[model samples]
Target: MKHSEFDEEFDVIVIGVGAAGAAAALSAHERGASVLVVEKCPPKCAGGNTRVSGSGWFINSSPERAAVFLRALNGSRTVAEDVVQTWASETAKNSDWLADLGATARPTGAYHTEAEFSEVDGADCYAGMNTINGEMGQFLLYEFLVGALAERGIEIRFETRAQELTVVDGTVRGVRVEGPTGEATLGARGGVVLATGGFAANPEMVQDYLPLDEYVLWGSPHSTGDGHRMAQRVGADMWHMGNMMTITGIDVGDTTGLFLALWAGHDYMFIAPDGRRFTDETKGNRHGHVQRNGAEELFPLRPFHIVFDEKLRAAGPLSPTSAVLPVGWKLLMENFVWSTDNSVEVANGQIRRADTLRELAAAIGVDPDTLERSVHDYNAACDVGRDDHFGRDPETLAPVSEGPFYSLRVVPLLGWSDGGPRRDGHSRVLDTRGEVIEGLYAAGEASATYSWTKDGGFHIADALAFGRVSGAHAASRVAS
Candidate 1:
């Protein structure tokens, strides 16, 4: 492609302005490559999932041990040994990289430090790094990256969405973008790095790729699988398409169509649509992983409902004023605050209420007799202070026999779907034949390293590590 064919040109073009994209742009610029970043959202909503995430990166003491841990976590769907080693080594430099970009690292709070899989090999190497001053789920870390990019005078075209790659003889050279000014072609002299997050917010893509029968997106609303589609159109091989990181929550359909917390009161119990208790209600799910048949698997998607009574309602709020991660369209972008005492939602008809358990069952469309029997059995167990069915903690065993029952429907809430074009250790997007597609790269959730199980801070750590890899490698490539 000739220079005249594009509206503008740069040595590198980075799509999506999250941790990965910002890292890529900064890395490329540091290497003397002129970089251009294009974000689909306007300046206010530009950070993607990184802004809403806990904003912590993994810090490992030993690369070799980290490799062992990663391999164990991957299980049968293993990443190549070389790629795993590269990831392990590269992640060790995360703190140094952040420091170089003028970021101060501090320990992530206890909330994020809880071990996800302590039994895995090399778990001893695990540590978490976050910005010195910032609240969890706030945009502080993302702000640091964006500030670094700005300090370098790197140009970011807010509201510019990359539609497709401009390919010449199987070599990607530019991006076709749609922006406020309408359609235009922007050339990349080095390479194009795709940092577009995941498909959690795209219902059609979620239905097509994930095995879940029902779910609600809890990631960035703009994460609609743009990078996946673009890469697939260019013949990039995909991986880990079925992998998902999920939490359980209720869909507050009014504000952002994102999720709200299920009942936080101790008196609540989760029941399937049939009104029977399922897993232990108070058990801490490891990103929605629960033990099934002595093996870990995703908490199955089902019509879940929290059955409680007036005792629970009077205890406090069913949902918090803010989301746990506080990312999605509602919390991060729209500033939609949840009710404090569950009164607002109940009055608004989002929560169903009734004068009796049978009436509550009817309101939520469950069999009244089945609900009554389940409650009776549950109350009997509660009275004895022993739950034989799911082994719920005796302290949390509260009877639901109080009058004026309530039921709120909930489902699996996806943090992000980890799947996209397959990329090698160098962050080069590969074709189906495992060969590099020249001038094409992917980083961040677009080509995440996690396949089966993800540890705390893995997503941001991977994004930062591979974002640099993509930028450095792309900068080395000769212009087509």
Candidate 2:
């Protein structure tokens, strides 16, 4: 459908009102360019994944340490040397830049401190990283950005979705948008910045790219890969479309409920549908537990269940509310329940319970004999204080022999996709033949910055760093 041209034009048009889009608009406006930020979701749900995230900042005190850590994290699939160097250097100074914008940095727990490198099993990637705790978590950080944008007179049209990029001659001109009113093409003299996030919320994209059976998206529902499809339509190159930062947890039966199963911790054992322990369960909550059996086997642990006795349930909250939620918020406020006791969940059929391992297996639709054998073997390992199959810590090992066993089906909870249109260090989108697409830029998860998983803060850092770069370069073109 052809759309009429917008009456008013701006120097820069930023797509998606997430962290990257917010930063891009702010940066462009700060550089004396009239900016317009368009968001698909309404103002209430505007911040995308950045608002629900833990809002940690992975800052290095020194650029040298930052480079070494990034090099190790991005093993074979390395980013360009100059890009890596720029990211490393800029991330060190990003904390101050963010602080100047009214966001404060602090240590998250104890691990996110400025420390020397120490090797853990799978957690060695975060060496010299710290976190940013706003005055009131991610909410305040997002509020600050929104407030800043409003103060600068940058118009953020909520409920306005960028449909396509409008190009003229060889230069990208602006974006065609569908808003609450109607469809129109908003012209941009500088360029259009795509900060539209990833495709984790799209099931078809997840099935085609990521190796998972049925994944639950824990991030923003607004991220439906709009920017990715739009960029591809313009001959932009893509990379690392298969990589994702995923975590394992039980589905609380609600489609939007992504509760991290505390039972997946050291206290319980994860058994596949065939009733066998696949991977070590002691590693932290962020580690992906989906195992691949062979070249043909994609997801060997689909419909995997966590087995635990009554003791673990009585210990404390089985599944804490998301860190994004404020303290003292009612557990029952949402559609799903979050509590230590599994009785409510069991009664609701979100969690299954049985008097015996055989009965439990039957209830959850797995082979009873195999499930019994798997439990017996795991209990035997607990008795001997040694995990032969998977080297799980002895301290977290607890026998599941007690009656009234409980099991909940768990699946991979996707945080975000680490893939999209490839961009240069200057934040200009590159095409298939490695040529820059003039007047087109991308940042945040919309661009393939961190192809491999690092820590939490790297995403936000990439958005801030490249958002500034993209905004500055785009505005510079307008000035010239």
Candidate 3:
């Protein structure tokens, strides 16, 4: 499609209005550059996955400790050492930086301590984490950024979608955008920053990159790989195309609903369709792998059952205190109860109830005899205070030999995809041969800076760090 030129020109055009894009716009404006931020979603839903997230930021006491965590997360992957080092050092000072900007942040607890990292084999290290507390933390951060942009006279066009990056003689010129008016091209004198997030919402892109068939999105529905495709058209290189950060234990029926079953702290036993325990149920409710057959065929795991007894059910709800549901969603689901009490869900047919293990297996369409034997073996191990099957902690082990049993059918949930255009320390988009693409920059989930999932706060922290770097670099080019 042909594009008409927009009357106004900008020094930097930042795509998407999430955390990274907001940071980039603010950073560019702070450097005295004319900036325009284009967001596909409306103003109300402008924050994307960043707003809906837990609003945590990972910051280490020192760069040395952070480097250890970074190296551990990028095992066997060839991430640039300078990039990782920059992330480490900048992240160390992020909390102070945010505070200087009037953002409140307090240290909560590290997901992984230095001692814990040493004990777990091949475990991703998580250290020095903080959460933006209070109910308004998420909203406040975005609001502050928006206010900053307005104060600097940087324009943000809402409901405007960036379609393509316009390149003139191998140098990026600007972006083609579709908005309420029409298709128009906005020229950027400095550069364009892509921060459009990932492809979790795009089924075609997810199918091409991810092997799992059945999954639910735990992030913003607007993450449709718009930036990835736009950059690829201009010969940008991509990386970690198969990497995804996933969370499991989502009820198949509740996939579209706001509620999520973060069963990390629960004592439910996960049984495969063949009626045998497959994994440690107490292990963190993230990372599910699709098994490939000998013929190199890939398929999702069969629907599994989360079996719990009356005693464990009486302890508390299957949902954890850390479970993230939108505040508005809580009001909508107020009438609907999701607890391990089994009364409310059983009445709604969301949970199956049985008097015995064999009957429970039959109810879930699994082998009754095999399920019975598996339960017997599991109960025996529980009695001995040991989990030989999956090395589960004995504290979470509970016998499933009660009169009333409950089961919930669950599947994997895709939080977000973390594969996109590759970038360097300066957040400049690079080609396949590792050469920088002129006048093009990428940050946040749009660039594959994070090859593996680290912790809850790492993504947001990385986004802010590189977003500033890219914004500063773009502004410098314009000044020169």
For TM-score, the strongest prediction is 1
lDDT of each: 0.83, 0.73, 0.71
The residue-by-residue lDDT of candidate 1 on 336-455, one tens digit each, is: 666667788789888888998888888988898998889998999999999999898999898988888888887777788888999998999999999999999999998899888878
Tell me the spans in candidate 3 whose CA falls farther than 4 Å from its real position: 1-6, 109-127, 133-140, 252-267, 285-302, 321-342
lDDT ranking, best first: 1, 2, 3
Of 1 and 2, the candidate ranking higher by lDDT: 1
* Residue pair clashes in candidate 3: none
Backbone clashes counted, model 1: 0
After superposition, candidate 1 runs with Cα above 4 Å error: 1-4, 132-134, 254-265, 323-327, 478-480
TM-score of each: 0.93, 0.90, 0.88
Error of 1 at 95 (Å): 2.2
Model 2 CA deviation exceeding 4 Å by range: 1-6, 114-138, 263-265, 285-301, 322-336
Write the number of the candidate with greater lDDT, choosing between 2 and 3.
2
Evaluate residue 39 in candidate 1 and report its C-alpha lDDT on the 0 to 100 scale.
Answer: 95
Ranking by TM-score: 1, 2, 3
